[model samples]
Target: MRSLLYSSLLALCGALWARAFAQAAATQKRSVPPGFVTTNGRNFELDGKPFAFVGANAYWLPLLNTERDVDYTMQQIQASGAKVVRTWAFNAINETELPSATETGLTYYQVWNSSDWVVNDGPQGLQRLDYVVSSAEKHGLKLIVTFGNNWAAYGGIELYINWIYGAENATHDIFFTDPAIIASYQRYIKTIVERYKESSAVFAWELVNEARCTGDILSAGPNCVPGSNTLKTWYSQQSDFVRSLDANHMITAGGEGQFFSAHPAEYWFDGSLVSDYNFNGQAGEDFAGDLELPNLDFAGYHMYPQTWYPELDFPGSNFSVEEWGLGWISDHASAAAKANKPLIIEEFGVTGLQNKTDIYPSWVQHALDTGHARVMPWQFGVLGLTEDGGNRAIKYSDQIFRGASPNDGKTHSTLTRHKYGISSQRLRVFKANALDSH
Candidate 1:
């Protein structure tokens, strides 16, 4: 009898311990903070505190770099007084369908097909992005997670277009019109939003990076521009879809500050000269109308005056670089003000190759003075030159890193490196212009 009683007690204790352990695990899964970043009138609020940020682009943070590199880079970013970072959350691979030369043959392109997205437990897949979210939280930084790309760099819209309609018939515009492609994209978005819904580290979701239609594979050229109505409809649908999944985060169109006019024939070249790439001209994006979406949380634009307006004889050339940049800011600010929404210059940079360092501080100061919520330069990384050359390259050791061949591109000059990285001069400008405009 005594032996039996002891055995029963042991069994009961084990059962209780197991139950407690399971409950603990469940609670841990739901432990993410409930509070999230939000917008009020025209300002952003985090945990009930007004938030303004000076940030940088680390587009490859979650996809290309290592844990150590992410850690080091985040530390440096936080140290530089940058409160937020923007990085890609989506990278497609092998999702595109290709047609073979033979009538009965079909081939699939696996690279850049992000549709096979899985949040598995490993260094690859969404595990790397999971690390980024957790690390950004640990180091006190907010993230702007862009969902798709307009360009072909990362199997962007082109991959989806090709996947739905074979590569032979693929066009960038189909990404907006095709029902099957839209469904596939929504599925991918659902997976991502469901996975990250509980985390507060994400500040906003960008529908696409510079969402524009430059034509299909065969007819590819600057002359091809998708209709503004098509682009806006797609933006509305996607923003609504994201809102359906995650209600806490904000949404942005990710346009390049292209103003739209109905009377393109009459008012085309009056304010700014039309160019294949110029947003004010034939570029398909309608910045103001896009921001007017009921679901879009804020207005955002990218400024590259040096590249966008390189010709001296351009209509706006009468203004200095600083004036041109400020004018761009003013135009966007006016639109945002009219809409009663906050504005962010999500991407802007002056290439050192252009010898335009003087334009940097001026732009920063003007942006702050104009009440822009955030100004994130093109990028921040471990590879660029620092003030004393103390920072070293953070080795990207993952297979994807090796496969992508990030280093295969042309090397930037030391001066360009200084401009891109958190050099002392740039840091000083960023820090000094960073104002708490609550």
Candidate 2:
């Protein structure tokens, strides 16, 4: 009798699993909110509304360069006030769809990887975008799509001969300078933007990753295209393209450090601004009156302090969590003023270095204190997921809220909801009271 009962239970369990799998398949097809923009809501807004984002970028996409891990990592991110998640086009969109493999619309290794530029539309690329867009919606997170990278930053002889210009080998080449490159890139961007236009999960269409100056292009160029000039031209073209197709959504360029400095070369896109921040550059440069970039609709900044500067590294390693917090806070204040726009602490977090420490609270407090930039701490489970694990993953129990581990089979999540207790209301109230006195 006992044996028979166990067998019956096993059969029921198997049936349930099969049914659940089918449901998931159905859900994928069922229309999901592509992504969202907080034009006027509390977390985020569209035109004149309150639009804030507490998010992070999924840097390592394993299947495509650690992207397989992103689905898992996002579970932890959702728990950490991350309403939006960013991904590169190569890692997230269809790349090889272009006419020639030499075309470059969006690539993974714009900074480091060296893959032949291929026409997008590969099954892998399509699947990747659908999976991410669908998955982000399922998990209540928004997607910020970046079209390009600053690969031009690491320009050298080899880069020039092989990568950009494609000398000896016709295969490896950057399609940007090639006149033929325009249509294909336009197609790729359109495909993505069109597909996800109705997606409420999509926050905004970011034209490019970083608007690196022409001089800063990794490989030297002929006319020496100015970063601002090149970006402005590119942004204008793409922005027009996106607007023509999808007029409902917002558009922005991934402008980080450029907005903080006083360099005239940094100026571009006269209409609306989507400012980006990196805590490493000119730490305390004021954003409002200091930079004169007050025409911003929204301010976005990246916060990966410890990774860039080892001195500012988090606790259990070199720098104390408190010290790191101060560094981030100072940067946040500067950018917030210059923006005079809603704040998006776009990219901020501790890296997954072997010597990992939990300085999340340091990050939380800074955001809490200012109430200026909506805080999106560095990351969720990118590093290791626990103290017992290797790299720089946050503790699941310490930071995350309710969420399942996408990588439960391989890694345990150390993230918890407790870490995010720095109340937004409390932070605002505190700042207000403190300010009145002054």
Candidate 3:
């Protein structure tokens, strides 16, 4: 959805990260060596060498209809020089509620039966995710697999509340506190972590995607208070749960870097006074507090000045989007340094193509200068791909992107049929091993 100018520096040094594995089909062992990418103060270290890199968000990589879909998508991402690919490892639906992708035999990690929810680990389920990890391992890419979502694209928090309470339109903040919801989410994550516990391709286990005090399906419920102590305790406890499952791979709370505060007007960005709820913790982000969590490995934030702070783009303010974006990045960078943890701009993008071309280069450069660990734009685009039946908003369709040609491979009947192919094994091993000589 978002784009950034290519970074040769990221390509040159990114692939040093190691660890994780893949179940090629069912539970077959993969070839990626067993070594983890660890954090040292403010940088990612693989075998004790700095492992900063560039990545892209391609949430649909594991949601495609066939192996041919995986082939072309992985190639384009690999060609773009991204070593890390963050994606959703989740999908949900009640027994009667069927998504269209299900009709096409696409995979969903979980589904609600008539009585209760169930994980679909058969060929209809986690095997698809297995192939994605296998492809990442073969293609020299590390994956940051998020367990669930805040929004309801593929069965996010709304689905959980609906399934649990037998009601529609429940708020998401309750997801942080409710005991039943917490236990349910833990079961889902435990299934995934134990499945890939020894795999060398998994870089990190992200707890959720852009979790916050509010969500799109409904307003904040009474039990869900924004800017309260809800998230800090949840993050600490859940991270402990994941750490207990896989001690080597890193764990992070996938938040938008919103810090909590009492006085909304007190927080300032770049010496400017603004009481925006985003910075004041009304959105339930505590970037500094997250960094200090005992089990979290790093901290992350997202940016979209055009949408999150539209005033910067107004004609009278004389403030450009990119200028404001730089300030946002600067604030998080300083916070990361203070906390002695690595930072990642997990998602960032502008809306217009011209604005992106003018803005993204400086953001990448600023990350380099500020000592941040990674910069992954909103998404890695592919030619001729349709998302959510092509109705998903073109939220960040800026910066002309180049992608591989449309998918041409034919569909197959069984999982093993598509497990191995030239494209699947076409990992950029040279770049991944670029730092081996040292």
Candidate 4:
């Protein structure tokens, strides 16, 4: 009958409408809005909802050779439930301009050619970063791109100082005060920020990887003594400069949470001479003061009490690893609360020999329980590579130290995989705690 046909047509129309509505809702959920990440009180907000995460450091992501490698790294990161990643955005290098073959058979190394300082082009340049950003988007991971380095590994501050002051005259302090060096750094920052300003995959911009004054180019020393205001001023300038360029993203001074003299006296682990060299109250970094900067969004610190203060008979002693780590977290979290910002453990890990696999998840639980935003372990390793073959495990180092042997290849690879498992566990903890907190 005509009435039966009319009813069937009405049902079909209703079904089509419902399907379209469902598809639209799914699309909206998948698409993160522009400037999607923002701070709400002490927590991060993304797409109008609170965002808490367990992130990891993939410092060498851009150095990976192919798109497949980059994609694989992201897959591993996502598999571990890490929603954010910290990576290096700078690689300062000395290049030589070869003369025409007919003219001369001589080559000269150039360190200061402005044109050669291309941060956005070439195979190993920002094009690689572009792929990282895109792949991270594909894998649903966010990036915290650090602008420079404090160590010499990736042509750090020393390279910039050497370019302007020559190797003999270069000092880490000059990188902060010298007008020419500051200008050069600002130009590099401008280049990268402008290029990636529109990408939602970028979660934040860190000023440097463990920004510190290491005295001069020749000495591998602890941070420079904190007698002057140059370092603080430099942090403010760089952070404000980034804010000026990109109004959407967050900023953090990538300091080591080396507290100044005002740090609580109880948390001071001055039991060893190494502490004097590494954690002296005068180590030119003020975590609390740095957070006071208006442009800086959050605070970050690394926890390596086992390595940094080894004299404190940990493991079996009253000062257990968990106690030591929890103390640091408590102190930094208190400081962040006072600053009215969220705290993130940007780096923390124990060696394979220490056998503290549970510590990673414990730290994550402690961080979430104590109102901290997130905890990112020291690093995530690449697949199919051993320590001897140049894959640095989270805890094992390929670089030989004075009294320690290089990490045993197979053992370290196993430990690295085990650490990945720990990270996966930490993610579970974060998820469970996040649900409870909400």
Candidate 5:
């Protein structure tokens, strides 16, 4: 009888021990946070976990794009393991892209005519913003939207370019420092925040789109004018304005190229901001200078091998894919490691290469492995579809960026999960058979 009792007691202890072990494993898993930023182990996370982005860009307007090409694009984007899409909030020209205040029968702003910003309260202009927010929620994607640019008519870069070059060839200025403009911007921010305070689809708010030639913008040159300081002040004010209105989302300037260093990130933006750079790592066009950039969250690089190194013959020009991808990855990685920030390839896509479709996955993988940057291809749609379709990043090339080679009038969608190291579970697959169960 004593022997029987001993055996029973031993079984009970073993059972308890197993239960405790299982509980401990559960606790450990719970300790790690999810998403892009985390609290332990790797020191950061994406989508609340140790994450990586395997996706493309969603340019222009989120509301209109999603309804039109986004549905198809999302399938490709999701299949590629992308959880975020980047776009611009307003076009520069104010053509008619701004949506109604309560448009789309939702809480977000949809795209109206690109000219809506120039004329206030026109028949179609006077509407409230709601559709944009709603459309994003419906689309199952997060938006990284920029507020300012020099495109169309809202002129930021165009004016600067003109100042740098000449007035005849320059674009007009959509100075941000104008008081009425500031007020109007504030109104837009307030409406967006109020409408989507509870929404989770927003990734981050970008302040401006690539402020090139700060010298020209600040100069007394013909197109230069005298508003560089005003523009700078306006840029700072609008950033603060957005932060004041809503503290829930992340904020960064949609700054292009040297603008990241044009204004130091520490002084201009809060510590949690993300700034961008183009092909080179050094300040200005000097690619061989020191690459350290202080206080940036993510290093951004737009890998256009054909642009700077035009001698090669690939898409933009002509270069071997291996050389181009390696060079870009090397530069991005060097900068990112210096900044101690996660890197993001803010934009990149095959423009006019013979084998663009086949080469995309290889380059993307190179970016993931070497650059260690989250990437967003360009443009979902811009022409007329409520979805993605344009020469921006994800579509065919245009006159400005068509490079030497051009598309052969073929539209194909052949996205595979393995290329991006992703699976249906949205986890990276390192090897064909080795799957991450978690």
Candidate 6:
């Protein structure tokens, strides 16, 4: 999801899988009222009140090039009225790693030499993350910090696999099976939870951005199977492991919300007469099953229509992309309701400001209407400098938006003009947070 649309719409999205705060050994702070956000079945409760919010995906917050960037980014998101922000808590650097353009700099939390890895909780490493948490607290916002990713974007699951087995030989799904790797992941999780366990600003801890039976550069090996059971067992173990560390905060499998149903038409929103692997247990995600994991507090799903299923976006399709997206949202909402767990539409967006303008309204409304969950668009972009140092985003997504067919490889200059303005930021941002239609 990071290549085309992301590059065009200003790339920064998050992933969350089923891992985190393990052991069930977690203890509440000595005498404090819960510094953690608690769940009320399908809804969230904060300070004894119902808590539902429009969050933002500022994945670059912890990995920003400088502290100034961190402070400024948080200010803008807080200004946007986004109650929560999602960022990567796991940043690892290796000679073979591939990260986003914004993920560069010395802001990593871990490092791998040729032999083993070192967790950096020093000033240059996780202290940046601590600042991110502290800044959100200062801004009166909460945070969802994801520990790892399935994609090889930052230091993902593959990164750990790379350290265990060579890149060419590494299998993605081994992360769930390897004892050494599991212990390593849990060690880092322990460090993070212990650090933020008492901070109310931490909304949740995501095990990985998006977990699956596959990896980016290297796919899964023989041991890894593309069914719910294999993934379910690993997720079960990880969630329980997380419960052992800190029992106060919430946890979720930051996932793409793929289902395990072999029958396509069985799901009301599937719109399929035949079984598609994405829906029929082959793609290693089972939304409802993930929710049932004991220590998991909620469920998550990412929506990307043009990327995952381009046929529907093509001509002569049964419906428009927005319509398909609406179905996807409804499907997940029903799943979350059935599981009686709060859901988060953590990552979703369409390119072309015009498309977003015409599309997001119904999708966002449908999401809010269907359940007690949060709708966080893929990102919150800044008026960044173009390669030539000019200041026009041509067309950006997030709250401030514009246009282009990233699908068709259209240039920024090729897009039809949409008057760019500063007012669009605050106005559209509030639109995202509030239920107001733009």
TM-scores for the candidates:
0.72, 0.54, 0.78, 0.74, 0.54, 0.78
- Model 3 has an lDDT value of 0.67
- Candidates 4 and 6 compared by lDDT, better number: 6
Report the poorest 10 consecutive residues by lDDT, candidate 6.
15-24
**Whole-model alpha-carbon lDDT for candidate 6:** 0.65
Per-residue lDDT over 1-438 for candidate 3, one digit per residue giving the tens place of the 0 to 100 score: 111233333642343223101101111112223466777666676664556678877776776655665766777677767778898899876666455545655567777865358888877678889889888888888889899988876788867777665455556777888788889899999999999978878889999998877788666766545546577888998999999888788889998888664554343456887677766777776777678886788888888778876645677776677877787888898888787777888888775544544466567666655667488877565653433433332112221112222121211111111222213222333223322322
Clash count, predicted structure 3: 10
- For model 3, give the 10-residue run with minimal summed lDDT: 20-29
lDDT of 1: 0.61
Error of 1 at 148 (Å): 1.0
Task: Give stretches of model 3 more than 4 Å off.
Answer: 1-4, 7-33, 99-101, 166-170, 222-227, 261-274, 384-438
**Against the true structure, what is every candidate's RMSD?**
15.4, 14.9, 9.8, 12.4, 14.5, 8.6
CA lDDT of each candidate?
Answer: 0.61, 0.43, 0.67, 0.63, 0.40, 0.65
> For residue 329, what is the lDDT in candidate 6?
90
Superposed Cα RMSD, model 5: 14.5
Off by over 4 Å in 5: 1-47, 60-80, 92-132, 153-194, 214-241, 258-296, 308-322, 357-359, 371-373, 379-438
Residue 398 lDDT in candidate 3: 20
For residue 159, give model 3's deviation from the true position in Å.
1.3
Considering lDDT, which of the candidate structures 5 and 6 is the better prediction for this target?
6
Global local distance difference test of model 2: 0.43
lDDT tens digits, residue span 1-438, model 1:
111111222222222322222222111111114557776666666665556666667776764335665676677667656677888877655523222211211111133334343333344557778888999999988888888888766557777776566677455667777788889788878877887878788888888898766642533333335444677888899999999897778888887877765444221345674543443435567777787797898888998766665654245446366677887888787777777677888887655433343565556556655666466767553443221233222223212222221232221222134334535555344333332211
1 against 4, candidate with superior lDDT:
4
- Backbone clash tally (model 6): 20
Better of 1 and 6 by TM-score: 6
Q: Give the RMSD in angstroms, all C-alphas superposed, for model 6.
A: 8.6
Better of 2 and 6 by TM-score: 6
Better of 5 and 6 by TM-score: 6
Task: Please identify which of the two predictions, 3 or 4, would achieve the higher TM-score against the true structure.
Answer: 3
